[model samples]
Target: MADLRVLIVDDDFHVARLHATWVDAVPGFAALAPVGTAALALQAAHSLRPDLVLLDTYLPDTTGLELLRTIDTDAIMLTAASDPESVRTALRRGALGYLIKPFSADDLAAALRGYARYRRVLAGTGSLDQAGLDRARRALLGGADAPSSGGPSRSRSATETAVLEALAQGPGSARALLSAAEVAAVVGVSRATAQRYLAALAEDGAVEIQLRYGSTGRPEHRYGLSA
Candidate 1:
């Protein structure tokens, strides 16, 4: 299946880049260049016709809610705007998701995953039965897809999920290795906790481990997602 194309709109270049990185790290999404103004965002949306947009509530030219009213594609609000009025307006304007700022990559990944699943459920169909509609709604609201039967299943803890998402955002090259401390900072956990999760993931073949040898103390253990 083709990946979902995402256009990120935010006034802060750094925040936009971070969002793009998080969006790209998800399995079924790709992000276009970030735009800082509503005008540029509208132009890009017209030219690119992205599958979805990661929009902020604030922009240099106009409010994101205003742009959302104008755009023809789907959107998810990513902003520091915590006001209830802002949230209601974004939803009223047809935002598919709303994420407050200072969220971890894990949070964004979950939203992306949910949206992807929602799209999949509603794709290629002219009409839906009640069950189908219910499934699609559940998927859109962050419910996990039903697991396949007859296999031993182990659901990951929230911390484990966060750890995996952090690793998924790595550079994916020679320098992709991330230390436990780095993972800890990203996941908002202690280094020991991060290391424990990393070790567990490695044991489960969910991540790749590399050792960094130094002249000083012990070799530093680093991790990346398995290909």
Candidate 2:
């Protein structure tokens, strides 16, 4: 594939710059421009016609979700809101993926790859039948199937389901998973309880845990659906 042009929109200048730097660092992408508001983003999109957009949920002038409705390019939502409803809303609004804030470069890379793959399938560059789409959707949802079954059969509780659903939105460490605390909060539980449920899911092969080490206090453990 050719290099993808990306425009990043975030109210935080630091974040927009950081995302632009990371996207440029990636091999097959060209970070076109980084804007700080929905109005500027729309203007840039119309003028630049970027291949993709990395947009934040909150903007000084308008909500990211609303901006998404008016845009015509492939987009990914980057936000601190990890709630299932928010994630679902973003996806329903035509976003290719939902990325929570504080994501690492590797996380961004993985999402880009997924978007690339999805684009390929949509463009007929890859073969994906109904079964394949179903499997991919299940995998995206972070659901595990039984050994002999062809579909997902849940053995987790409602809390575990909520945690898994949030994790499905993007990759994150246990600490970062707190971004999705609204899931547990909606169920009326503390963040600690939500963490415990995620930990349990990790232990049960319902999720995958990865240790991320950086210039920080302790190595952070991020989780995703077990593949």
Candidate 3:
């Protein structure tokens, strides 16, 4: 598959460049040169036909949410606007993900990974089953909740099996749990990939997650085989 082209739409040139660098670091995304105004953004969206837009809430000519309404591309609101109204509006406008400004690169990567997962889950032709549709939507949350199709009939994918195997080889104490990075190292995959699978497993009741709180940010999740 071709790398998903991303148009950076932020007024700050330096911030846009920094975000572009971060986007480029991910495996399957490419960032176009950043644009500062809604006018340039519209022109680029028309001409470039990018697969996604990393949009800032504040722009020179218009609000990012308003611009989002006019653009015909997928978008993630990367903005400083943390007001409840702004967040709710972005969701109503079909923004794939919303990241508050000052977010870490890991935060953005997680959102992008979730969006990629969403695209993959919905890519095939024909009408989707309820489980399939639910899975695709949950992918927007990075699969934190997993697919709800439970029971003995529920089967694990090859990658999920690999993640489980990695967990088995990890620290063998009753309370021991491994982070996604540790599992990724063992499985020879990116942390983001490992995280996506691990989160699903955790949510499906196939694995257990231990939330380890640190001094800052969200608590780190560690995984163990469910007993």
Candidate 4:
């Protein structure tokens, strides 16, 4: 298969180059020269005909969605603008994926892999079977087609489900995630009981626990959802 050509569009020179480098590092992807304005992006797309574009929401000349309307190939938006309107517009304008900013390189790689699969499926010769069509559809969405079997998402014993729900929705910062004591209070259980549940959940990829450090005290386990 041929390498997937990607045009990265962002206003910041440093960020654009960083993403360009990351794209080039991926096994089946190559980065085109990035552009800082929507006008340049449109021109690049017209002339270069890249397989995909990594676009930002804001451009010095126009909005990314505006540029999206003119481009013919697939696009995956990578932008800091997390507003509902922008997300909706990107989808409505035919974006293939929406990746929020501050994402890891792994996240971008996953998207690229999914896009590659989608393109491959589309290029297949024969009519697709149910499974083949399903794979193609899931690739565009960039995640598993099914809801997680673990966590608070399924039917289970009443006691177990209630505890999972609490941890799944638990909110905390990087510095201070909800501790076992806090989760215990929320779920009407003892601290030790909450800790046991959290540990189990973490092992199952339902949630994660990290230590929060402070200048004056020892680090403590803080709980957050794996997502």
Candidate 5:
């Protein structure tokens, strides 16, 4: 089979570029375009007709969900919105895979491979047994639980649980989490307190942190659960 064509759409220029690079790095994939707006994305989908789309839930001009409803392409949602409701909405709206942001190259590659396998099965190229489907569903929905490498045994508080749930949706640096603030606000804590909790989780091996650098002054750190 020929390499699958991919279209990446995100309002953030950096994110769009990053996704494009990741897709290009995949052996059986080629990035057709990385667009920064819903309008452009729609146009690309109509014209380029990529095999897959990496979509973001939040956009500058329109909700990613709204754009998704209109597009005819096979889509995989890539978003920082990790809430259950959002995830449910994405899945219900026909997203093949839902990936939270700040994902590692390995995780992204895994998602792509899973989606490719799904496509093959759907196209009647391969038989999808009940067991295989079950396993794929578990992986798609983040149910393939893998234990963390190292972490303290302290029980997670309710607030901590909320924070972890948010992180599970996508990776974020402490600064980014502070900027979003929804999880912290939902859990009824100050931003400073949330940072401390993130630090603790990182220390416990519940989350992993990566240093991100750009043209900006200081390199920022992002966190995500060790999936």
Candidate 6:
């Protein structure tokens, strides 16, 4: 498929243009004409049908989160707003990626890479089963750490705590990648049990998985502390 088209929405035309430039520079993305208002953004999205949007949260006509819910495409929110509520709301409103203001080009590229991965998973052959769908969303949003309707979590269990501790300490070999099996042995649990904890740890941003390529066959999955 061709590169995903992007719409840049920010009140400052310069910033919007800059975002468009950034989007265009990414290998798998193309930017549409920058729009400086929410009304125009809505209109553009409806008419142009871009694959993704680069939304500015501080729109003069309306709040970005409010616009986000009504838009058809996924978004990577751009804003100077540093409040926790804004982050929560943006993610809740179907934002696949969130980029705080004054970010580098590299940062935007990383977010785009994530969104690309998310799309690739969805576009793959056959259909995604429930767990596969969940994993794909996780790939998009970075993790499942968003608070539930009940509000933020208060605590972690013993096993969860131990898993976090192990992940904190690097797996000790640059050549060898950590796995649930290793973590399970360390925690004195089964690999399946270790995976459950590891999944939580990954959601909480404590661990990151890397693919290990061998001389032949399929690549293996390995774990490590998040950078």
Model 5 per-residue lDDT tens digits across residues 25-75: 554567876988898999899998999999998888898888879999889
lDDT of 6 by residue, 103-124 (tens): 9986886677567657656766
Query: lDDT per model, in order?
Result: 0.79, 0.69, 0.81, 0.76, 0.69, 0.73
Worst 10 residues of 3 by lDDT: 144-153
In candidate 2, what are the lDDT values of residues 59-121, reduced to their tens digit?
A: 999889999899999899889978898888899999878889889986886666455444433
What's model 4's TM-score? 0.61
TM-score of 5: 0.57
What residue runs in model 4 are displaced by over 4 Å at the alpha carbon?
A: 129-131, 143-227
Off by over 4 Å in 5: 125-227
The C-alpha TM-scores of every prediction are: 0.66, 0.57, 0.66, 0.61, 0.57, 0.60
Clashing pairs in 6: none
In model 4, the Cα lDDT at residue 23 comes to 79
> Which lDDT tens digits does candidate 4 get at residues 165-220?
77666665423368777878888988765665565555456667666667863456
Q: Where is the poorest 10-residue window by lDDT in model 6?
A: 143-152
Q: List the residue pairs that clash in candidate 4.
A: none
lDDT, residue 200, model 5: 51
Which consecutive 10 residues in model 4 have the weakest lDDT in total?
A: 143-152
List where candidate 2 sits over 4 angstroms from the true fold: 125-128, 131-227
Q: Compared with the true structure, what per-residue lDDT tens digits does model 1 show for residues 1-227?
A: 55689999999999899889777655447789999999999999999999999999889889999998899998999999999999999999999999999899879877887787677667755888888788877866776443210112477778888988888776666337899889989999887567656655654567777667789854567788877
